[model samples]
Target: MSTLPLFPAVIIDFLGSATAIALSFLALRYSWSLIRLQPNNFIWGFLFYFCIAMAAFSLSRGVGHIIKILLIFGNRNDIWHLLSPFSGGINTMLMISAAAVTIYYHKGLQAYKAIRSEAEKLSEANTRLSNSAEQLQMLNTHLEEMVEKRTKNLSESEKKFRNFFENSKDIIYFCDNDGDITSINTSGRNLLGLDPGTTKVNFYDLFCHDSDLLKYLDELHHNGFVSDLEMECKGKDGPTRHILLTANAIYNEKGQMIGCEGIGKDMTRLKTITEQLINHEKMASVGQMAAGVAHEINTPLGIILGYTQLLMDDFDENSEDYSNLKVVERQTRACRRIVADLLKFSRQAESFKTSLDINLIIQEVLAVTEHTLNIHGVTVLRKFDQNLPMVFGDSEKLHQVFINLFNNAQYAMVEGGKIIIITSASKEEVVITVMDSGSGIPDAIKNKIFDPFFTTKDVGKGTGLGLSVSYGIIQEHGGTISVKSPVEHPETREPMQGSAFYIRLPATGVANHENEENLYNGGNTGIR
Candidate 1:
């Protein structure tokens, strides 16, 4: 029974050994392939080497078992027993190698995991850095745009300030504490008659009156500013101007006042207009009084003149009574003449209008006054424009105006002088200029010349109503009369500097057909 069991056991041991060897070799081949694909992988390397160790272990055991079986069958039991211990020792060494390889693989795997985690962290950091760089670039672009916008706004603000400074009509000026003008706008320079190249000027010098400057400075120092302070300033080339000034002190960053900034509004034209209105009102009141006085006094003066003439007729030519009566008559006639002039000045007399040729009226007046002008040693020069326009005025009244002007001219020229009569026409009016070479009207009395009872001649020589009456008549006739004294004349054959009377009359039409033939040739016609 023992020998039969031994036969089955030997067969079984051979099959088991062969199966273990085959499996070991297959594991080794697969592990080597895994290692070749990932030669540097710790896990793959460890697995390949461990498989080699297992295969060696299986080979040693299986070969030893196979040899023992053969030896036993060949009756070599002693040699089999001796080789069994060596094979077992070889198997034990291979098992130890496999365990060492497993431990090494575990350490290598931990290191590889750590390295991978660090690489992931580094990649995330790089991504954040890239994002920050993109953000910084965007911020820089936005900053540039904001800077450009601010610069553009500042430029526009400067341009606006420049435009206001240059074009403002009111005089804008800046002056230092010493009242030395440091900066002035274009209007200020023009108003003060300053040249563009002039850098500095004294503000006090512009004031017409020292009192005005003193008051301005006092108020400014006391109040830190001045508002609507009226002052008169002398112009470099024109009449004194009126200005309303407003000023404020200029300060630096330290709040210390360094200068003054001022604005002056020119009010000269308004002042002139206001004065004219007042003068007109005064003249109207004077005219009303004169009209009433003349109406009351005219009839009585005429009666006195008639009675004095009768008394003169009753007295003998050589008697003292006749002389007294003659003096009374002369005085009465003078009073009547004064009353008549007052009536004329008041425009109380009725006027008849006609299309009168101004040139013809001038000629008639010159013909009538020729002897008187010659006696006064005055010469008359006529420059009548051909086809002179007609004037819508009473012929007799205009004739009287020319006669009065001639008389005045004759008186003005005590010494021999020329009287220039020029007639010219424009589309709007006919202009008659009566210029005389004589003593010019004084500037002080120029404004008062047209006032009733205002006269420059000797008391008995003038009623002072001639010009006043002429003014009223011209006004009624829709004309304007202006005078320029000490008239400037270009160098000519005769450079006359005296007074010129410019009469502008609204034209009626072309010259009357009947007077057209009498229109003298347009040239200087001398009359003495």
Candidate 2:
């Protein structure tokens, strides 16, 4: 045991204390860096305080060791004794502080772990809340879009219904319980001949007859609806219209009848067409029957005429028997003539058709009938358009038609009158009007004038076949014959105090001048 071992021990002690102090200072510096990065962190703050305590302990112990070595080398034992206790006490206190701080650091670490877990849970909750908020916004947007689309669809449906209501062709109307009109469409207004601005009108007043209105209301009241109920409706500016009406009773929330709504289909034109078709069918049947009867009666009529003539020859003149025989002969001849007219009316003879001027045919008819007309105190007037078109028809048949019209005019005016013959051209047809300033035909018999065996004159004066034969001839030539009486003035539709017969024939589209010369010379003309 020498002083050499003591020097080695002191040197070891000083080096060990300095290494501890350096390591503690480096640890404190790193802990300070951790604190700077997370200043409020409990773990880092606790660790930094523990590092400071360790550093202070290491510095105090290392300084005390170095002072002892210096003191031993300088042989200053008394001063070493004085400084050694204070340095040792300070190192002890720092070691205790470092140890206490290390124990408390573990408790702080447990608290820090709990705090970090709570923070993570809070972060997860915040993330979930954000997602929920975004989903809510998306749902709101989708709901808004659905609402907007529904609104648009509703608007479109309303517009379509409104369009149908306004533009529908059928007469649509609504009326109140008291037969007062409430609302009506454009077609309804037009059908009733109402003004554009008219709103209120009595439904009962629209009916052409009161009986029809009463019947319609009675049926409607008995049943809640009416379908295809036919009725005539009066107009403000025209004739009554035929309609097929369908209606449903309108009701309030309490189911009490408030009014009625209906649609009316116009059937006026259809009714006219039906009547014409029926008339055509009837004429066809009558013509067939007439032809058969005329054929069957012709031979008997001829034999009766031959026998009557033979009887007349046997009787002497100025005798009662002779007079009676003459009467029989004349009546037989008249019957034969009627039979001949029936044959013509039934279209039994084949027609000879050619393109000819209607004016030429009329002139020829006048040539034959002018003398007769003048004798009857009837004057003839002509109104022929110069640029007349050609018509393809039988000349003989047309001559018969004009002759018949002239004779009727003469008979109609017993006192005397004027007869006018007018010829004009249209776009596709030729129009001829035979007008007479005589007594106009009675309205009751006007429609019957063209029926076979129907006549207004006394039985012995006429055979009642003239107009019917003319009608048949005109029909065979694909023309129309219509009568108006009293004849209307050309400009004003007022009556001209006479009767007018209008004939429309299809044009041949050929110039009338081509056949004008041939017509006078009877070139292929059948007017014997």
Candidate 3:
């Protein structure tokens, strides 16, 4: 192989040596700068130092080439010598420039890395801020939902309160401390006959009498509540209504009086009913006492009438004394019958239970009433269903029920009417209906016809306990008794003409059969 050029070798050696020295100095400087940098920034900082060192080294090399050219002058014919050294120097400069370019590229890479790091940090901060914002937004949404829910709950509660305040049955009114009406319910408006939309009534002005208002207010203030204080209320109409007011004071949380609220219940009908009930009870008690006394007197009266009749028979028939004594005996016998009826009503007899064919029993009762019906000129119609099941009942009580109904029909038919007694059978019940065609019960007196001592008959004509005792006896037989009347006619379309009473008894094989037996045993059966 041909020997390599010495100058080129020398140029290569110098270039390599200079490169080594520059690299060493740059490495040291880079290490020093890196020592000052944060550990995270060390690598980028070292790269920057190396690039600056390389740039300085390229400049030095270019300057060194010019110095060498000025110091080493040679003959013109020895161009190779001059050109050769320059060529090496140029090559060294080129190498240094290339190294500087490499270093600049490295510095650029470091700057890019720094910018990227800053960008990364910014991105992380932005992500954190975005997450926080999202959380804040969710919190705001949750708070808003809570507020909406609370508002809805409050609205519903208000609606319920208003409903209760407006639709109450009692006459309700809210009054300010001055007793002026602040709010009134529909019932209150109705009670005062005030138009709900137009009339504005002051509560105090509704008092029938002026003297009662102050007294009521004072009572409410003193007691904080007043119940069942009865008074009169002036309605918009001409009439005044009796009312019972129950009032209470409204107080705030601090126990200070705020206003007054009152509930007025119309007591006019109730008071009348109470009075009637009281009178009925009193009459019933008096009837019972009278019955006991009459029972005691009946035995003596029977003895007296018996002796008087015997004495009258012994006397001459034409004697005036005998006629007088006959009259006395007849009147005494009538009084005895009345006393016996009173006793029958006052004392409820024990049911004498016996298995009886209901059809036979009804036939027997009709036979006994045949004479009476004939005398009243009332025709009797019997429609008995064949093969009716036998019923266990008190014969005496059942006889009494038939007797009372027959007699009532007889009395009702003063102008002569038809009486219908019908018996029908169903799957689980047996019904008996008694219909009268006389001027059926007057509407005004129909409800009270069964009440003790309540009779439409002239005094002494009726004991009045006939229907009542009959009602009690029938009820004790596990039977339901009800009355029905048409308010209007079917063919003529006029007002109803008569009433019918229906009695229903449970059939023998049903679950209620035992209830029938228990009822006949004089057990306390509730009202039918």
lDDT of 1: 0.83
lDDT for predicted candidate 2 compared with the true structure:
0.85
Q: How high is each candidate's TM-score? A: 0.67, 0.63, 0.48
**lDDT tens digits, residue span 9-54, model 1:** 8999999999899999999999989888988676776777888888
The sequence of per-residue lDDT tens digits that candidate 3 reaches over residues 437-510 is 76677656655776777887898688787877766666677886666663343225566566678888766742
Residue pairs clashing in model 3 are none
C-alpha RMSD by candidate, in order:
10.0, 10.6, 14.1
User: Relative to the unseen true structure, what is the C-alpha lDDT of residue 109 in candidate 2, on a scale of 0 to 100?
Assistant: 86
TM-score of 1: 0.67
In model 2, which runs have C-alpha deviations exceeding 4 angstroms?
1-170, 183-200, 208-215, 236-238, 374-377, 414-416, 439-446, 491-494, 514-528
Q: Sort by TM-score, best first.
A: 1, 2, 3
TM-score computed on alpha carbons, candidate 3: 0.48
